[model samples]
Target chain A: MTEKIARFFAENRPATPCLVVDLDVVARNYDRLSGALPDAKIYYAVKANPAPEILRLLTGLGSSFDTASVPEIEDCLAAGATPDRISYGNTIKKAADIRRAYELGVRLFAFDSEAELEKIAANAPGSRVFCRILTSGEGADWPLSRKFGCDPEMARDLLLRAAALDVVPYGVSFHVGSQQRDLAQWDAALSTTAAIFRDLEEKGVALRMVNMGGGFPTRYRTDVPGTDEYGFAIDEALRRHFGNRIPETIVEPGRGMVGDAGIIQSEVVLISRKSANDLRRWVYLDIGKFGGLAETMDEAIQYPIETERDGGPAEPVILAGPTCDSADVLYERAEYRLPVDLRIGDRVAIRATGAYTTSYSAVNFNGFAPLQAYYI
Target chain B: MTEKIARFFAENRPATPCLVVDLDVVARNYDRLSGALPDAKIYYAVKANPAPEILRLLTGLGSSFDTASVPEIEDCLAAGATPDRISYGNTIKKAADIRRAYELGVRLFAFDSEAELEKIAANAPGSRVFCRILTSGEGADWPLSRKFGCDPEMARDLLLRAAALDVVPYGVSFHVGSQQRDLAQWDAALSTTAAIFRDLEEKGVALRMVNMGGGFPTRYRTDVPGTDEYGFAIDEALRRHFGNRIPETIVEPGRGMVGDAGIIQSEVVLISRKSANDLRRWVYLDIGKFGGLAETMDEAIQYPIETERDGGPAEPVILAGPTCDSADVLYERAEYRLPVDLRIGDRVAIRATGAYTTSYSAVNFNGFAPLQAYYI
Candidate 1:
């Protein structure tokens, strides 16, 4: 845990099982990313963490937003972000919502299907539209399946349709999936975008933007490359594929921007053996899958943990949340080792949880308090 | 779908992806359970839904509540339930929360570990404490692992320790698991309770209560025995073991009480083929795993669905939620056959969702609205 985070929690003695975010760290992360990728426009994905404080902080730093819903757009706007800096990033949208977003001055939107395109054409006529292209999403910790994007052929057709319908065929966007690691994934994503760019050119529609959707990896359980390495690789990919013809690039960094800025301080509720013969210790925390730790689902994103007794001998433990649900177990399959001396009231700091923890908490499941986020 | 549920949505024209609960159905279910098991007191699990309206309705019907946390106790009290009518059912609780619940006048509590018992002893002295014993929770749709219960031997020792710590060893409890089927599972659970009862008797602690913990199955995809079957089996088990010396019985029914009382009306956001050549159509709904359908995790509970176009030819489809997460797909493994002609703007009514849907919603995940619940 960062000294600043530990000091905040230790001094305030704020409620246990709460998230503490440092705005100083967030600003530093933002500066680091912008400094590395000077040319790429930053659109912070609001879904990662929709706290108004974070939004206002990012907005003050002149970061644009990639929103998934109208509420997010409203949140950004409430934080003094102009509507022009917001883009509706979710491909699946209710038609009514599309009209609502359009009325709210959201001109840029993303869609991956023909039906969505028609809905956009009907609701937000003359607005800018981008089609998300499908990628295998390999080499990412949280590899996305074929849930959001379409094929290159479909993208070309959709772009043409967007242009013909009087909506500006703004660009093509593709997510390498959240927490993307290997830089080679960018090569495939960029190559696919370049192919669609050539196809769109053949059909007499010039795409003006390339949205390299958020997937930039954050430091978690596994080692990952830094922002500079990612920036270099992305710059190389753009040069190798589009040469000097690279369109206005947009990077939607969700976890990469804010994951390391926050720490969740959870209290140990109890520790016991699962059974008399079972040697493995079961460590139950006040916070579980429902208490703002849903990203621990399938252990796809493992947050580094820190406790006061970290130097003691480590013991493999089955960690669980406080909910009565059986599936609330966090680290059973992907084993977690913690200090054996940890006891009740001992704080365990879940590091780098700033992005998804607060937003994804289940709304008072089992009557547990919604995660209280404290920004320092 | 019930006519009342369908009519409410049709007439109200509420926004897409909302939960509609019929209090009349809830009252009837409550009456049926109470009517069948006259000897057992009903404690409606607030964690199942925790909707104030539902709690008030249950309170109006003279039903006690089984709360899991301090907030739940407050919700129950706000709904006009007396503190004596509430039991803290969660085995894992923070010490501070235990004190808070005690200060709120909640005396009846459940614990499965010594740590929790000690916390209760220290915070809520002389409180009525129940120790939960372990069971495999076999043959249940949502089979619970060894997350909430202690082994019988440990439970016996814990009860003694509770008495030593000046807490009343008021009862013994055991859950067969949520949505538990196989009436034989109850036989095993009850027999284990009988053995523990005998052992406690030998140790000079005559238990005053027997909490044949909730696991009464709710009708979902699979056909389940009615309340009468459960009541009959439990009555027979008590007769065979304790005869005229039976203790006060308590049934903490969460899903069983309210599952059949509600239906969720979600709009079909989009319908598209997974790929150009993929045979299955993916039907995306406005409400998904994050949007109050977390019970569908890993296809553990399959909710029966109805659409307005139900008369059309059926086709196997992959059901998904509208969130950007790939894991938000609801029923990819358990294929759902829906109307072939189902289109966007159409409504899908998910049946028997009252118990788990409303309370388990993600707090504004992906900027989608939390599941709005309407009570009739």
Candidate 2:
């Protein structure tokens, strides 16, 4: 889609290097994801964009929270999300963090290893546990094949071990990986999960909540689905997997929830020649791969950077970050056409960067100013 | 080189997740580069590791400072590098930042575009400018080439423009990109710079410095040179470019100075399996891309991640991050056989991360805590 990014830029608060959150886009995203997984529960991943305003928007959209650490849990709590409505998805927790989360009444916790099971048993004594069965896919952005998923054989055995330790295994939770472009991977992985569930049922293991976790797609381009956005396949999978029997599917989409909602409204800092005598020069904006690609050096979930004039056709130019690092690329090479005569301080917005753009990326390694936040 | 990285874990400071800056290595780096370019000044690029301790060490080792922005300028100034010794490398600057630097008496500055020249002329008319000629090479781990650099042909014109604007073109500066591995590219680019300097000198553009800006190599490996133990091509290039030249030949080595000086020492938190039957399980660590590979994600700078326990022969394992984001990877299929039975809270130190780890990475992303800083 030919997005009017400049207009979105112009409509932001008076912070040059600020992150702009589009409430309307976020609401639409919530509705779309909630509708697609009608039987499932949607927990907005707070880590993506944990600005107080964004959290409030997620709360208003009738979504729960998927918090990882204590700060996330605290942020959700401060944002008025109840303890029961939040699940600590990052199952590996510090001893202090675990006790604090347990104290805060966070029930649903994800676990991948036997050591973690024992820690959970010792910490809370009887906290509700969700064994995180990490999934694998061929085209997965972050292949979950190694992260936190227990092998199906080991997972079953671990479940028995946890049961013996008085650690209640709520259900199985597996992420097909973030930004999953291929939908069939989800189908096959879910089929594998389903088999595990059936085996657990036969063995009389408490198999209750099958968290066909969140990796649902959000369209970055009109032509294809992003790494996270599975397009129609995920919706169809939801329909096929639980045709008659409904399961409590918990999805924590860090990028999908606020990815489209946020945009980095920045100025054209330096417009200079990329090479000697190249036809066009680059439009260096205040935000670079370090800022807009805050959570990512590679995976930037944004609509292409396109600028507009008052009454002229849009021109796309290669937009980049302020860092001197060459790898600090924002929009890929010549992907976006921008106004050729773009001057310094000319405002442009990098759309769909609301998620994982600000909080996730604030180290200021180059000692540049940290990104200020604003909500629209 | 078989680097004993376990020493970093036992460095006796900070929490499980911490950055250990080995002062000894940093001093040697500063000494080697300074000794090689004895006649020309060496500006320690503050963007590499802006931590106060790192800055103190570099400044203590008799190196000038190269700053990109105001905070960096302030950092250099605070480190007592003096404004005259600090060169504002960022060509794009607002009137305020320029005025601040000029007021602080920053001696040298760079401008890539004519617009920036005009602005510099209007704001800091008395300041001398460096005509940054764009060099062609693509292997910068942190590529600054994409943003900075003017066409050599147009740069010739810009040199004349500087003459007209009364901004002294004290020297010509061109970077061969960061993490530049190709020595031949430097040879060609410096030869091109020398040619441009000669042409400019023929055109009555007198110069005092030919800033062969730093992209010197430094890694955990010994065969590549410029690692912890040996100096790389810094002296060879100086000999070729400025042999017996009366003018100062400048080199601003950020990564080269500290890339091997610091190591990201983190403790393993948990290890989990992907599927029930999968033999592989993930070992999650306290430090992640946010703290280490925060800036360079897609083309992440590969470092040697080693465990501290010196037991039997080393074995390689996939170390994952604590963040829930799948793309948050610490290593790409890294293998270092230190110990087979690595457990939770086992310390792992990632060498060659000193340059960008603390400087570019942010804390509070994904609600994870930031790495505590410690220096020897």
Candidate 3:
């Protein structure tokens, strides 16, 4: 935990199951990403955690925004981001929402299908649009499904078709996947993107941009390569694929920008074993899947946990949220271990939870309030 | 769809991605369940959809509540439910919350472990507590893991311990599972509960209540047995095991009581295929998993969908929510089919969503507001 966060916790003693984000850490993360990829423009993915404070911080850093909905566009604008600095990034958008974004002075948009392209063309006339292409999503912990993108051939056709419409055939885009570990996955995706770009150029479209949608990693249970390594690899891939000319590049870092900047403090509500011979004790926390840690679904994003009894002997424990629903379990097979002396009411710090925690929290699922968040 | 809900939708024409609940349907469902098992008192599981209207209606109908948290208890009280009609049902709870519930005059509680029972004993002194025994969770569409309940041996020990504490050692409780289909599962669970009761009686503590937790099915994509069938089976199981000494029984029905009473009308945002040869069209709805169809995780609860053009030729489609997150896909492997003529801006009604939809909705995951609900 950052010294700022520790000081905040020690002083305020906020309620348990709350997230505390250090704004200084967020600023440092922004600078690190900018320094790592000097040529790429950073568009902070606002859906990660659209706290007004984070948005204002990124906006002050001259970071562009990749928004998922019209409300997000309004949030960015409210945070002092100009409409020109925002990109409507979600491909599945209502026609009315597209029109609203257009009316709000946002021009750049994303599309993965002909239907979406048509919506943008009809509603946000003359807007710059990028066609998202499908990736294998091979090396990411939370691999995205085929729900968002289309195939390369379809992307090429859609971009070519865009030229015939009122909207500009701006570029091609693809997400390797979230928390992407294998840097080579970027190389593979860029290769397909370069092919699409070349094909579009041959058809006289000449796409001018390449949006390598966010797949940047953040520290979790295991160590990950720093932003510098990812930047070097992506720069090398661009050089290898695009040869002499790289298009205007953009990186939308949601998790990487703010994930490690925050911590969630949860109280151990109960700790007990199911039976006399049960080896694993079930440790119930005040926060859970519905509470905020939705990323822990399927034991995917294992957040590093720390308790007051840390540095003492620990044992394997099945962690769960204090909800009556069975699916509210955070981790059962991930073998999360906690200190043996961890008592009920002991505070547990869940690390790297800033990105998806607060925004994904349910609205009082089991009468538990949404995960409270405080920005320092 | 119920005539009431359909008429409301036609007359009101509320905005897209809203849930419309038929209060009459809810009342009828309550009447049906009560008629089916006159011996068992109904405790509406408040977590399913804790709208104040539903709570008030149930309260007026003399329904008790099975609450999961202190806020739920507050909600019940606000809806005119007497404190005596509320039970603190979640096994994992903070000591402070226990004290709050006790202070609020809640006398009944459920626990699965010694730690939880002790908390109840210490905080809610002289309260009635029931120990939840683990069930196989077989023949359930949403089979619960070993997250909420304990083994039969551990439950007996806990109840025995409860008797020694300040809390009353009420009888046993067990959940066959959510959306349970097998009547024999209740029989198996009751056999274990009877053994625990008899063992406790021999130890000079005669348990007085058997809290059979909710497992009652609700109609989803396919038809389920009516409440009469479930009530009859449970009654038979109680008779076979208790042998004329069926204690004060309680049935906590969440989905079974309200699942079929609501319909979610969502707009089709976009419809497209990945490639020219891709057989399955991807149908994007304005409402997604985060928008409140969270039960569709892993395609477990397939809500039957109806569209304006339902009578037209139908084709297999992959349904997804209109979010940038790829996990928002609702039904991919479940072979969901939509009308071929289903167009963008068309309204689609997801049936039997009254129970888990609105309550499970994220506060605003993708800048989309929580599923708007209208109780009529």
Candidate 4:
């Protein structure tokens, strides 16, 4: 919708349906989160749109990464992020994957099982580990406690075993779910985690870190509170737990840090009437679901479409992707004004697709070429 | 979730995820439909999942394809399918895309615009065409009639204009919609289209082809009927319209023809609890939203997930993907039994992820590799 974005078309390089991120917005987000929680460490959730540019930008802002896969680990390394700055937060990893992370000099690893601890002890005895605690007041979107986390009692067992084995169990971590709406849920998860830490300390394992997993929602749907509030609450809770001597903390915000900071723009390919009520509008966007927007089924993200660069006003239109599925629609109730005389070949912008918008949900259904990403 | 599918993982060979069509069931489906509609044309929508093997199989079974993209054109061509056998059914036009389809000898082009016709006329002189009529069926999950079909008046004008262009314009095509549930609504669309055909013939345009565009639903939910009744009924209605003298009738059955023929076998890696009630289990076996089963989101396709190698039934567990999104769940309120003490390493099988599955939705997120395609 901006002149600079429109100018991308005049370049005549690629076709419709691609993603572009404004680095300025990303830097602003990093600064906001880091500024709010000065004592806590920030680690970008690389799984959320891990473009090389994005990784480089976050690292440049002095943030580390939370990577789950070997490829993601490789991405952080290639982006010049030191291995110590990266947290291999995923449990149930392959031995080879763990070995790869160790080879990369990643000192902080998140773990759950006795088997995993044995694997790490055999592979890298120098690793400083985190024993994950299942501490939701029972409301985290990820009943992570049930599937992945060690029960508080079980966690004490694991940490005590690690201490005896001479493996430095430095931290305790738990995620309060992604897109969290209730601030009290986060506050409760932290409070419960602190109890687990104190209990572990009493059992002769002194904790050096508290890894508060990322679930800070972004400023998208008003149903959930904004990112700034998440930062402030997290800061306040960290003080309660560590009491001015806050151990190093890692906050991995995926969608919250970048969801609103980016937009996906596309071009209208055809506008026709399907029947009396359904006005079928197809945009030959550079960004297809596989390349850009892939969440087209069950739940669709918002596409606040803007027709004109200069708002003559707004129009409501149900925009669908070029994919064949009827569910390929990006918006059903979405209304943005098109120039009443909107024609074919006109371009439009679908806002708020930056986080988990493209790479997170994208799947190449038609074998279309992957979308090209650019930083403005 | 039978052991028949779990064998796929025992011998792990990496390949892209693709639609695996059962030649036996495919032939049966064709015979079944052909038995019902003795005189109708079967045009497969290649955009569903255009693996070359599937394409060749359908063509061998005597079914044509409904293509929407240039790569699809190339796919049909690679299968040795004649240009006459393939119809470019996309109603939108990017001049280059249209020209590619036209240059590839695509005679039957679906147009929703006078401007599109003009472009085809200028670029593809004397190209055979069809003016798609927009439908108003509320039965379709996505009513394509809204986006790429000409209204009755515009349809008439386009027919007249085609007559003036000194080119060949065939009969009309209207896609009732994708995932259509109601038969009466399609009957209305068909009868309306039939009336328009009569009007076009009276105007002396000499209509010949009647393309009832794809929207036949294949049953995913057990509560709905999954028979070929809708396909049979649509054909029967068309029979009543022109009696024994109908034009070359065409209908594209995308999901219905291929959705349930294959299975995606995944393995349960981590089983965790989300809340006290919901289990947050991440089965990092292999299948993902990109591999095709991700479509039925609100209502996930209840695929029978089984253990590898005929292992004895284990306890019932909830399944999910390795992707960190709280929403990345595969089954909804369904139970899956694993090998009693299912651990970090185990395999699970998911049935009926063939149509609109795989071959499209792949993103290099985390380190999860793309799917591997194995055809028998």
Please list, in the order the candidates appear, how each scores on TM-score for chain B only. Answer: 0.97, 0.88, 0.99, 0.83
Q: Give the CA lDDT, 0 to 100, for residue A224 in model 3.
A: 94
Candidate 3 DockQ vs. native: 0.87
Candidate 4: C-alpha lDDT:
0.67
Q: Which docking band does candidate 1 fall into?
A: medium
Best by TM-score: 3
**i-RMSD of all predictions:** 1.6, 2.7, 0.8, 4.8
What candidate 1 gets wrong by more than 4 Å, as runs, is none
Question: lDDT per residue, candidate 2, A281-326, as tens digits?
Answer: 5777777666646533444354545454423554545566776676
User: lDDT values of the candidates?
Assistant: 0.87, 0.69, 0.92, 0.67
User: Residues A1-376, candidate 3, lDDT per residue (tens digit)?
Assistant: 9999999999999998899999999999999999999999999999999999999999999999999999999999999999999999999888889999999999999999999999999999999999999998898999589998899999999999999999999999899999999999999999999998898888888999999999898999998999999999999999999999999999999999999999999999999898999999999999999989999978889999999889989999999998888998998899888999999989999999999889899988998889899999
What is the TM-score ranking, best to worst? 3, 1, 2, 4
Per-model TM against the reference: 0.96, 0.88, 0.99, 0.83
| Tens digit per residue, CA lDDT, model 1, B107-212 | 9999988888899999999899999888888887885878888888888888887778878999889888899888887778778887888888899988899888
Model 2, C-alpha of A87: deviation from truth (Å): 1.2
Task: Report the C-alpha lDDT of model 1 over A1-376, residue by residue, as the tens digit.
Answer: 6678778876898877899888888898889889878999999999988888899999999999999888888899999998899999988899988999889888999988888888999999888899998888788787487878887887887788888786899999998888988899898889989988988898899999999988887898778999899999999999999988988999999898889999988889988764566678889998999989898887888888888899979989889999878878888877789997889888898989998888789888988878999887
- How many clashing residue pairs appear in each of the predictions shown? 1, 44, 0, 50
- Per-residue accuracy of model 3 over B50-73 as CA lDDT, tens digit each: 999999999999999999999999
TM-score of chain A of each: 0.98, 0.86, 0.99, 0.84
Q: Per-candidate DockQ versus the true complex?
A: 0.62, 0.51, 0.87, 0.30
Which candidate number would show the highest DockQ if scored against the true structure? 3
